[model samples]
Target: MTIPTLEDSGQGTGTAGEARRLAVRGDLTMAHVGAIAGPLRAIPPAGHDLAIDLSGIDRIDTAGAWLIHRMVQDWGAAGVPARVENASPDADRLIAEVAANDRPVPCHVPRGNSALDQLVRIGNAVFVITENIGKILAFLGQTLIVLAQTLVGRRPLRWHAVIHQCEAIGVNALAIVGLLLFLVGIVVAQQGAVQLRQFGAEVFVVNLIGRGTFRELGLLLTAIMVAGRSASAFAAQIGSMKLNQEVDALETIGMSPIEVLVIPRVIAMAIMLLLLGFYGSVMAVIGGGLFCWVSLGIPPVSFIQRLQEATPLSDLVIGLVKAPVFGFIVALMGCYQGMQVTGNAESVGQRTTQAVVESIFIVIVLDAFFAVFFSALGYN
Candidate 1:
């Protein structure tokens, strides 16, 4: 095949104006583009009409078509009439594609007013939050329906899966949960003692540790830790299943993915969170009692006695009630985000991170609501 060449014929008057004709010959593919591109673009000032002849092109590809399209656009923008002529069907289609895609990208320009920009951002955030709330509520409704069906014996519960999840979420987390709460308890007791010592009321440190652990710190911290650990795991596990089409496989076999995968996890999280919260509270109390005995000269027995007298049964009840609700929220966020995953591994990772962050945020928000609610009810 001959190398591509661009030949400029002498100018002549046409219907529009004086016109310069450029003839492109031979195969107009990537291999020949470098040979002809410079000469084609080196034409005199763009005052005259220009016509590019492609009829002599034996072969053409996207690269050559783009070059021709660019030259036409450059001259056209400079007040010269420019167009491709005598192009074969394939060449015309390629050039048309190149021309169609040669559009300027839109750029974002910042508004001058900072307050208006802030308001716009706030509105967008509110819109996104409202949409996500609706989705989570819908998912909650579906989960409750499936759970009710299992309770009524209409659908079988997978006991083995539930047990496995319980072990993973609760039993495996015992060491970390116990250790962290113990440290928190020591901090609370030491701080309380320091403040109360000035007033000669150091013994009241027992009240601080006992009421705080039983009512707030114990369950709240447990839920946050579980959200970080188990919520991410649930999202990753189910998201991987989604990526591999295993969730689709279950549906194709007439199995509900919610029933087979989600119900057991939700049940296990609720049950384990309740138990873990109680265990963490006990560990915290132990640490507080140890601190009192060593630092304040308050014996373990006196510490136990003061704690029993100071902390109400209502405080324990409040913590217990909130544990399962927090657990359900964490599990729901994880499973819902997992089901929403599509496309590839990146989606799984993104959903997993979203599940963890959202779980923790929602848990803290609910914890605040519970605090206000119990306080109004005289539980404080």
Candidate 2:
């Protein structure tokens, strides 16, 4: 069983200056809440701005303060301002804290766009593209400067770093590149053989495989692999370093991060791509030969003879020429995007994806350009 309890009472009035004053009184607490309801209701409704004086208040709990808070809020909502003017330091603090906590947070509303807004967005996109192009070209210039320094013996090139990248970007990637091209070669040969068999010209499958592999498919496929693997790795690695503040630490210690990081990677890609492209072309031809021998009953010797005649040394040279260019573009694009990373894990992820996509796009565009240029020059 429990006994009911009530709070200490208080008074409120209109003063000589005709100021509406609500004098807080009694031990206002949660348990005695029922006692204050009549007094609170007794206070006259808004004749003027309400000034609450807390001087007479003996005690208060959060509930009592909130009751006072509610009186002020209700008065304010009714177009009358209410303030606690004579509260004790502690009472003032409680009121202030409650007020602070109860304050409404502002909501943000997105603005509706007009036609001008759409144009502004397009303008912003173009500006960003121009800015990105400027940065990439600046990075290219810096890479060339570093290369020049290496050639003139002004700066020691990190041969060790280059070798390590070659192992990673080139040697480790060989198996995948070879396997994909080999499967592609088998498919091409099988398809070509099936069609040519109608005219009793199945032996021409070797010519088709050799010409396609050497002229276009070999280097392009190898570059796509490098873009997917090595480019993403470059962006991720550098972006991680940026996130960790290691790039700043490098500058603090008097090191050029471009030379230390970018130079080796760029050089390694150029060298490794040449070897990888050649290796991929050879594997594709071998895969074609295997398919020819097994499925078409064309002898390996006949396949080889037709391949040598079908794809001349000039075609191989043209493909090899494109390899290092693709590699340089891949590495440069990767490093450029990596350097653009802000100090965040999300930025790292975004930059890495951008690096792979941009590198692949550029590689394909360059491949298309080469095809046009060679056709115009009668290289085929």
TM-score of each: 0.72, 0.73
Location of the lowest summed lDDT over 10 successive residues in candidate 1 = 10-19
Clashes of 1: 0
Candidate 1: give the clashing pairs: none
Per residue, candidate 1 scores C-alpha lDDT tens digits across 8-41 of 8867555555578889999889888889988877
lDDT of 2 by residue, 243-281 (tens): 888989999999889889998999899999989998998
- What C-alpha lDDT do the candidate models reach, one value each? 0.92, 0.86
Report lDDT (Cα) of residue 277, candidate 2: 90
State, as a TM-score between 0 and 1, how close model 1 is to the true structure.
0.72
TM-score of 2: 0.73
Global CA lDDT computed for model 2: 0.86
Q: Backbone collision count in every prediction?
A: 0, 0
